[model samples]
Target: MLWGALPYMVIVFCITATIWRYVTNPFSWTSKSSEMLEKRLLRWGSLLFHIGIFAVICGHIAGLLVPIEFYHWIGLSDEAYHMGAVFGGLPAGIIAFAGLVILLVRRYTARRVRATSSVGDWLALAMLIIVIVTGILATSANAVNHSGFDYRTTINPWLRGLLVFQPDPALMQTVPMNFKVHILLTFVLYCVFPFTRLVHMLSMPLGYLRRSYVLYRRRDGAIYPNQNQEQQKERAM
Candidate 1:
């Protein structure tokens, strides 16, 4: 299973990266107002998406880094674990889902936005929706599947094994196929990440914010004064 999954993952990443490298160059894709709007959607969508995504990533990293025993040693009972997992996962899932919905709606509902969107854009959003929805379902199902087996116990060992090229199938088997599909979809998404507009994820923090701040300069070479400055000064007085 690892062998089968690993190669495709690598190939996907390579293909995605190559495509993104070419496409993201401003010179490659020509547009004026359309690009501007895409940038706008990206700004808002990315802020929500990246914060949620980073939280999810941090949760995953925490799962890998902190052993179940550590939590247990610290007095985290099963109930506590369940509560923490539910609270952490649910909000992250909702944020990701909302971000995707906003992006998709912008793509289809806005005339210029829809025209500017490509087939790849649609595919990326569809793939992300699948991954996020499946993940939410998997988390819900897990609550139902709590059979006294401490999932926390297995994560660190599994991650250690992954680092050393020895992923334990037993741990993998413990995860349901639906969950497995969600994991696989995530892998596929990563492989394709560099290729899609999803590539914006990597560039988002810098690109998104930079694009949002439209600057203007005065003829005297000073930055243009904010129109709100006088209002703020009056309010302060």
Candidate 2:
């Protein structure tokens, strides 16, 4: 039931909740960065986490979305792909996990941040950690240890088919336990995504490019005599 129904259910919920949140409380849909409360750990953690996540996302897109035949046609063997996945994915996962730990610690240890953090924040962190850990386990078990369970054959088709409304639950029957767990957790993450700070991931800052320039001035209203004279001359002109 989970393999067949959960993905679609989560997709609908994610879309509905995201739209509801935007319509109801659009201004609250932000990351709510706590940089002012603590910067040192936040700086390192944010940088490493974002970099690792970008790499991990790219790796997933290549491994899952692109068919294995494309790699073969390009003169890339399965062994080469497996080795690259392990070598590249392991480090990226480790880095992201480490940064998440730092961020978690900072969130709890920093007095001001802890006070300001909502329950949703902690829930998001917990779900992210679970998903990342399971993903690492799945990647390590299959790619690093040579488990002979080529996910590209089974999982790839299942996932792609699911996207096109052609889910074949039988394909997941032969899949390993760790991979199944990772996939399930990912779907669960999507279910909770719209309610958490993860929603910020959907945002793009294109507005900043066209924003008006901000001008600053002294708080005091008093103007210098020479400046006043210059302003008056310009006004007269």
Candidate 3:
């Protein structure tokens, strides 16, 4: 049931919830930046978290979507591929988890940020921490044990089958316990994604291309003589 039914259910829930949220309250779809309250931690944490997570995502895509045969055809041996995965993925996961921890700490320890945070914000951070920790455990275990448990033969195929609607539960039956936990938690994260600020990840700044240029002025400075007229013109345009 975990391998077969849960994935599809989460996918449907994510898609439906995302659409519903968009239609119901489009203006609420923002990351709600707190840079004004605290800049030091936020700058470092946001930078590391985004960079590491992007790398981790790219690794998952290459590992799961691409076939083993293709790698072998390209003259890459199985041992070499696994080595690269461990060396590359382990660091990326560690970096992302570290960044998330920093961000979580900043959120609670900073007074202004904490006051503004909602339950949904805490839920998102908690879910992310769980998922990243499990992923790190899974990768670290494989790196130390070198158990020859080649996931390309099992988990990769299972996930690809899921994409095509022909998932085989047997493929996941023998997967390592840590890997199973990570996979399940990942889907759980997806289920919570649309309802959290994480939804902002799906947004793009395309509107900036056509939107009017923003006007800025010093808070205590005198207003420009034509500021009102310029504002009126932009609104009319």
> RMSDs, each prediction?
6.7, 3.3, 4.8
Error of 2 at 170 (Å): 1.1
Best candidate according to lDDT: 3
- Model 3, range 1-237, lDDT digits (tens) per residue? 789998999999999999999999999899999999999999988988998899999999999889889999999999889889999998998889888999999999999999999988999999998998898899889889978887888999999999999989999888999999999899989999999999999989899999997655646442544456666677577
Per-residue lDDT, model 3, residue 174, is 84
User: Taking the tens digit of each residue's C-alpha lDDT, what string does model 1 give over 1-237?
Assistant: 553357455766677676667666744332123546567675666667767777777876766667777787988887887788779977987787878888777788788788877777788889988898998887777777765544466645665666676667577666556666876787777765655655544333466765767678666444568546665566577
TM-score of each candidate?
0.71, 0.91, 0.90
Query: Top TM-score: which candidate number?
Result: 2
Each candidate's lDDT (Cα)?
A: 0.69, 0.88, 0.90
Model 3 residue 210 CA deviation (Å) reads: 4.0
Residues 50-153 of candidate 2 have per-residue lDDT tens digits of 88888999988888878878889999998888889899988998898888988999999999999999989998889888999999988887765767988788
lDDT of 3 at 168: 97
